[model samples]
Target: MSSTGIEIERAAGFVKNETPQIVTSRFDVEDSHTLVGYLATGGYEGIRKALTQTPAEVHGEIRDATVLGRGGAGFPAGVKWGFMPPDVFPRYLVVNGDESEPGTYKDRLLMELDPHQLIEGCLIASYAVGLSQCFLYVRGEMALAQERIATALNEAYAAGYVGRNILGTDFSLDIILHWGAGAYVVGEETALIESLEGNRGMPRLKPPYFPAAIGLYGKPTIVNNVETLANLPWIANNGAEEYRKIGTETSPGTRMVAVSGHVKRPGVYEIINGTTTFRQLLFDEEYCGGMLEGRTLKAFVPGGGSAPWFLPDQLDLPFEASEVGPAGSMLGSGAIMVMDDTTDIPKAAHSLTRFYAHESCGKCVPCREGGTWLERILGRIIDGHGTTRDLAMLLEVGETICPGDFPHASSERLGLDAQRFPYQMTTICFVGPSAFAPIHSALTLFPEEFAERVRDVTDEELAASAVGAVPVELKGVAAQ
Candidate 1:
């Protein structure tokens, strides 16, 4: 069991196949964070083998393996590396360690328990991409992870694994450890680059500011998630074909899923990608060990807090991006938050909206103003001061942020339908859509819960007033 009372279990025959533990392989070994301990478990061997081949060869290997980014976007790491404009000198590699998504703790575990593995992965990536320097940007709240990585860096530097002609090869690189001030928006690649350059951590607009083309300090930059790069050592040691055999064809190898909420055993589990289903993850004894006692599963946040919620109907869906994306959610950040029947839907939606509102950097007007507006409306409903108009306003505000048909669970109770996943966004980043996700999901999935808390207004009154037009009753409620 972990410190949070969540039991971390290894992947077993829940899928009738033995899942290979890649990143979390050394997590159980004692002193695994140390160079000596890592060496005993064959650490740094990947870099040693990587040095034997040319940079292009190592790059091709990763591209062939199809290692998707584990942070959230699920972009292939090699394809991202290939975007670096050729002949560009002084290219930098930024490892994103800002694991700030709610219920997402897999990167922190990887950094804290096996720092050496991350370093080795960085070394391999640096060599393959010809990066001049590397930056490991960890979240500010992860002090233990920062300490472990810092210690590992010092050990690596002293032992010649990092810096100056590593392993007698022409490659020389430096790994710098930098931590943020706990801003959630910095998890975005361009936003993370802004923070690294001593800015306010706001996301940069694409087209003119894609990180691969024009990034930190106006040069080429490749920002990969910690988990994405951590898979490098294994891909380097074992052939890509061998790695491909573990999971499905589209999503090969294993992924670390951090499960939380009402489940009995709710910790990180390395399950073979695309093979496991929500039913196996939540009910299988090796995974979440089923919902708490007699409480049946109500709903779950499929991919971190930002994703649209999923109901019991999605239990049998495979935990794959292709399947989940078409099912009205994503396997984003590999974070699964379970909620049982006893959960309060309105309050839950209010809690998540409040987080996005508080974390908004105020860069985009839709996210800055509209997100807070949505939060206030949800809170008012939760506090028993909301009117029927508030429900219409919630969807209206969400539509402004995510224009067009928004994705939501089936609302058969009210005869209201929803579109599929991947809603259109007006903001520069997903933060605006994230703030509205819970509202859309909760209202669609469990409309009765919200209706019970709100004061029903006459249809004539609702039709007479326009959305967002604060009436006398809501004036004081909105002010509060």
Candidate 2:
């Protein structure tokens, strides 16, 4: 057995059968993308079964299952559906296929492999909410996924399963496929809605413009991620109780995690939420098969690029949101990026800071200014022109630009009732915090790397640099 209690011999011989294949069941199957092959695997059965029951029944079953949103936030999916206003006409449903987060590619694979499943999930969601038409906002770079889904949509419409009395029932719906212009901020639901309406992809304020109350052409709307809707069929067919047994009591069902960065085998793997630890995920041959070139683990991004990275000590923790949240991080987008000892932490932080700076929509002051300053400061550090004061400046600027509040669900099972701080959101959207997460975490987790780049500055130099309040205790800043 390896250090993590996983049998090395067993992991070495691991096959696809070792793990529960929920979302990636079709990965090994031939012709899985075609309509005929999808039907052979009992596709569209969920919507067919859903049409027999009332919309409320479908919603209740999902709520009982406790399937949280797979897109970064970890909010409960059923609760979001319930927020739609009652007796409201022209309600809309949108599938957020705009996956622009770095190191996260699970949604793109799901769409390419099982477009039929997504279409069926979309149909069930539309029925539950009385939405006559639904739109799928796919990432523009994913041309292959777009082609496959477009083909599947044509097949479903021809078979009378998509448009006009689906499966001979009164519930008729239409599904439209739209491509995005590759803006990271457009991944935000309201911003995606704004872009869908032929406008710039900038986020709208809350309260009056909440997507549940007012969205997409000023109507009630529910914007769900692609992975969230894909799970509906399994819940609809197998019942909520059965689905709950797959994962932990708090976060049930399997989720696809995309593993990237310095690893021997970097790809996507589906694991039951909270059941697998970061240690097993990294060392076990079934997953990443340990680090590349036999190097020791140094640090890793626990979630997506927007999430704070975790050190080796936190490796025993589960990959679920409930476990990672209280530990001062989140399971954002379920993308784990592993880094080895040879990596330069300061250089990496600068690279990610550049991404957020370029992706900022420039809608609000905090995000725009904060992102630009972060990029420039990190750039200076990488070029060996930074001072020790730059470290405090990074954290201070991050706090000023965005609140470091953890992402939580509206429900108790998924979030905490106790408030961390008085609700003080400075920006229009989460882009500010998203930009700051890596920069702040990099400094906190790998201080030695930052300290190495910091030059020895005289006391007079510190005052001249406008860092008069810089701590006098710091090594060279006080005096010789």
Candidate 3:
């Protein structure tokens, strides 16, 4: 049977995250992050283990711990690491430092505060994946992060953590830095790896397969997210079981949740695995401050931008992968976008669809063309172009491109008819379907918004720009 998802089987005393625990590497908002500071906090301990232990031992430790990628696709980190061939001569460890997921900000906080935590994580990842060379592919907009990491890398090198035959075990590595021009899809592991190889940063097909088998110039490579790598030192220093002691059986270790929208404290907070509850966040942690005084909770994007959004009634479900997937969503990047009663769910989803439309890499026709077409259709509908049948039509078309399709191909589909297709793709059910949920739910939940639209829809005069007549947001922010 397939792995459904992860849930908290038997978690004891709940750990409410009132503030960020600040582990691994700590970045001070206004203070200095010197080399001494990182070393002082027990940094580079993972690297020390890697230098002393065998690759098999390191692999077993990671596999036993159940650490998944912190990016959208929560693939097993150890499994990805084990796929690398021992005698591949040379391999690569590519770190995805791009934090373009709309609602996510955990990695940014980590990079801003403790750049070396990531560097040290990359070193351990490199050692485990059997690569002496690695690269941190950051987004172009993160100039300050680039500077901070650059300085940290130099400091690491000066201390002999990186470079030739050092750490006294003959294992040496150097991590290079690269930047993306800009694109949300670049966060995908394959796309980032492609970008590092100096391409357009579009994702490639699997099973020609995962990067751990063959990546970066047609050699074996293991691409991991910055946050995933950040936990390496902690995992090594404390044992695998210690890390496992936190999260659920399937999803172990703490997660830095980035809370945004309709919240009093709209920032990143570190919560122990399976310890924090959704209600605790709103009522206890006071991040949401209890839904804008009078308004009830509308919905929330459980993950970051690409994940599904849920209604207020479903708040009691566990936020782990198991609980989330069974409930028709995924714990994407732990970027919880809580929407209050005032927010229009459809309009919010449309706003997200627009982002996906702009950021979609044109590798496959479905994600590229389908996303664009959906945005246009949604744009017209949101701009008072609805006539009642649009909702069913939207859901239908979502299924068409979800498994994806080229002129004559698709992403991970099985056959012409969806019946032959996997249950996962056929329903158009997970996150992509969720992109439509907010809008669909809103049309029913907040009929007043649409009634106002049907009665008072009007176009203003602003046609004297280079981009022609474009749609504007509900709050009047034009879609340019």
Candidate 4:
């Protein structure tokens, strides 16, 4: 394995000890965005080589590689590709570029740092999935990245990597960038396809409705995350065995982790999957530097924002979706959000609940109404104005959003706690179980703080709102 030659910093980057040069192939390129610069590196070789082979051959290569979707679900990428039917109408390899999930800046990093590599990955995927066209549905706020990718597409066409008869071969592929209006739901494959097709972004029902069976324009389509596809060329060129050498048996290859929270250094690092534990990432970052002095660790938001929080006791857990799930959380999108000692859990839950409420598109009544109620109740509780009954009410709201085992009424759970009186039931989203984690924990762990809030003490007596400097997004990645 190529030892990632750069000097390791205390924190930053997606996954630590990332694949030496797999995704980041041109850190030193002069004007890395320019065509000339890309050509200087081994840019279009994968596409060039792929064009000479049959579509099935390329598909076979990807299927053999066993790359799972990096956007959180960890679905098998090859299986998703194999699902695409043989239709010439307009099969699309939709690139899910909506980076709205709180801890997922890795796609932005890849797009900004090496646009060409991503394009090549797009081309290969398009070819592998028998797509004559591909779409990169990027988050609307990323205007600069849109322009960079547009420029790269133009250059790729000029050099015959895109457009008709690419690279002196019989195959042709074209990639276009589709800008999103910006919604977190758009990260879901069907929702993304809907937004790309100019509709409000909301997840479509499944079954007679798989994206590969009937997708955008009512044709078979396959949507893959930007990072998942970006790793394509490397796998195609280097072979599956080469990619498999680094990570565990099931989760082969490196995973890009967007590490934020209390640590010495906070940034994105690419690590071999299952190679690092939660403990190392949290306590070791020099930038964020563990939790602030007196503060102890609180829950962590693993995966994307929707994933359950992991308490400090779960620190030894492996960092993979399958592994994290059994522990009652998900390793969603590789975003490891660390909460420090002084953080108020209830307030934090309220903050994220508010984000979901604002972004819930309203296409569906449950998510729309449920999210709003969740934020209101949780926010009230965090502000120290809630009764203990309000805690049960919060759980009711959490149930509204995340109805268990998938019942229709559950999904549409916008029921209220008690329209009649005190002895009634309640309604809600994950914010309930969410509110309890911090609220209950505070009641026990920091009883005095909860007591002050409950007794209507002065603001100074309220748990000081876990103050710390939040990292800023500079260009592509999050910075401390």
Candidate 5:
């Protein structure tokens, strides 16, 4: 494993050791984005090695490595690549670069610092999946990243590594870099595919219509994250066993973590999965070098904005999906958003809820209406007009939208049958859950902050409002 090589200064006037360098080893290297620079540092060796092996062999190695998608879902990438139907013609690969998830910027780092590495990874992925062309969908706002990738693509094509018999082999592939309209929902694989097809970005229904079987003009396709694809070259160059030995047995290899908010050193840091703790990420001299301004750590978003928040009590937990998931959150996108004690949880929840509300595509009623209501309620709470009943309503709306087992809302408490409540399978996509995770987490973890904003109301008045009872002044006025 390569070391970070640089020293990080902490807020406490101390220098922290550099972190591990796997995905980000080339980040600080001069001219790292260029083909020549990448070639000098053992670049394109993965494809050169991969070209000698068959597609099945490539897929087998990836499966053996257990490379999960780095794009928030943590789905197994090798298995996803194998989902493509056999003997299919004109299969395509789409690289999701819509890094719009709040607090997540790891993908953008790879694209900006190592475009050639991404291209080689894409080529290796295409070769493994028997693809002829790959589409790189970058966020429209990322001009520099797009420019870097475009230049690299042009260079690859000129070198005969992109089109028409790549590297003197019968295999041929083309890469197209497309920009998005800056929609967060487009980060979804199906929504991204829809946008790539010139349609409004909206997620497609699953089952018989999954992307692997039907994607990109209705042909077999495989969609992968930029970081996920970048790892292919590493696994291709070094065997899976060596790669698997670095991190935890289940989630192997190093992952790029984008640490932001209240950190002494807020930037991208690469760490072996399941090997580092959130506490070390926040306080250890080698990582973030402790919190900013000597502020005590209150809570943190373990994954991206969509993932649930974690209290300081969970600080010792490893930064891995398996551990975080069992602890009531996930390692979504590996985005660590640290919040200091002085931060206002309710107000922060309101801001994030409003973002999701504004970004809702309105294709699904649950997400559209639910996100709007969540933001509005949180806004009212933040504005100092919330009621105790509003807290119950917040949990209810989140449950109705996402259909999860909300621990606060027991079936017996509502006097309703468990089977009758829509608490297990709710929305059309994961957006509903994403929109509510932070809200539910805020309400669950920081009840005192929310309670401080709650307005006092009589039981009679609250019950009257619950049943939509009209005010005495407005009741007769409406009729008149």
Candidate 6:
């Protein structure tokens, strides 16, 4: 028996016979980040193989593999490559390494430990897509990661692995390392492009400004996540069929998962994509090794902080998008955060809302104003001056961001049936919805916690207690 009272079913095939170490294969090697060490471990072999094949052939292999973007959106990587306008010159590849999503640190580990692998992956992607130039946008806070990649870029260029006729072939490419200013909003593709062009890092509306069609410098571009690009070298080297054998049919190959919070061992683990369940990840000794001592599982964020929280009942679901998405959350960014029974639900929700509130970019009105509003209300409830009306207002404010049936776990208190995820949103990007995710999950999953924290406080008391007075829009909901 584990700490959560769940049986440790080690005999079951939840644990694969041989775990596939795709991107993380070189992590344990001491000098894996160095060009010499990376070369010894079959680093640039994928790009070498890629250069031998035609661009279309290389693209075909990746497309056949169906490598889903390891970034939050989980879109197909090869398909994204094909989105470039035919015969368009100066096509660009922007690598998203701005990993600011809370509870998501897998991309940072990849950049810091095996930068050469990421470079090789970048080489493969640029070659396959006929991209003239590549930009690696790393988060500013990751000084070690930026240093490692910059040094690796210099070594790669000197070794002829980058810049003009790579490995003595007709193919030529240039990879540039660009640092981000540690803004969470730039994690969005277009916003990253905006920052790269020396503008404010705020997302551009879709349709008129899809990155693949009209991206950086008003030309065709492909923006891929660090982990998503990192997988290309492996797929190019092993072939698509070999990669498919590792994980399930839809989500082929392994994914790096960063498990944290109240777990015995909380670190990055590359697991077989669809085969690994939350229970296997959280409780399996090879993964997180169950929760901390004396901590029974209460709830966990299935993806990053933005994903809707999952109760203990959903633990058996696999870490696949198909499985987790229908269950009212997503396996976004491959980050799993565990919370124990002792966690204060209202206070915890307040913390997440506070992050989204602070990081709003002030581009979208709903996200800028509504996110801050949601945070203040949660804060007020946590400080013990909430009313029953305040709970209703949380859902109402959430509805303004994500309209019509907010994605939530089944709640007996609210007499609500479980709603599925990918909630309908009124905002431009997911930032507004991200702010509401924790509030909806907390109120729906554990209404009693909020109820216990609330008193029949007068309107003046509520106003006095809150950091920001409740907005007029929310004030209307509270009155009702």
Candidate 1 C-alpha lDDT tens digits along 241-297: 888888889898889888888887777888888899989989887677798767798
List model 5 lDDT by residue over 93-127, tens digit each.
Answer: 99999998888988888998899999988998898
- In terms of lDDT, model 1 sits at 0.88
User: Candidate 1 — which pairs collide?
Assistant: none
Candidate 1 segments whose C-alpha is farther than 4 A from its true place = 1-18, 410-418, 458-480
lDDT of 5 at 192: 91
TM-score for each model: 0.92, 0.89, 0.81, 0.81, 0.90, 0.91
For model 1, what is the error of residue 360's alpha carbon versus the real structure, in angstroms, after optimal superposition? 0.5
Q: Which ten residues in a row have the lowest lDDT in candidate 6?
A: 8-17
Query: Compared with the true structure, what per-residue lDDT tens digits does model 4 show for residues 317-342?
Result: 77765666655556768887777766
- Stretches of model 5 off by over 4 angstroms after superposition: 1-20, 407-425, 459-480
**Global lDDT scores for all candidate models:** 0.88, 0.81, 0.67, 0.68, 0.81, 0.86
In model 3, the clashing pairs are 5-322, 6-322, 27-113, 346-439, 406-409
Prediction 2 global C-alpha lDDT: 0.81
Better of 5 and 6 by lDDT: 6
- Top candidate on TM-score is 1
Cα deviation at 18, candidate 5, in Å, is 4.9
What count of clashes does model 2 give? 0
Pairwise TM-score winner, candidates 1 and 4: 1
Off by over 4 Å in 6: 1-18, 411-416, 457-480
After best superposition, candidate 5 residue 325: deviation in angstroms? 1.5
- lDDT string for model 3 (136-207, tens) is 888888988888888888887888887776577677888787888887667877777778778887777755
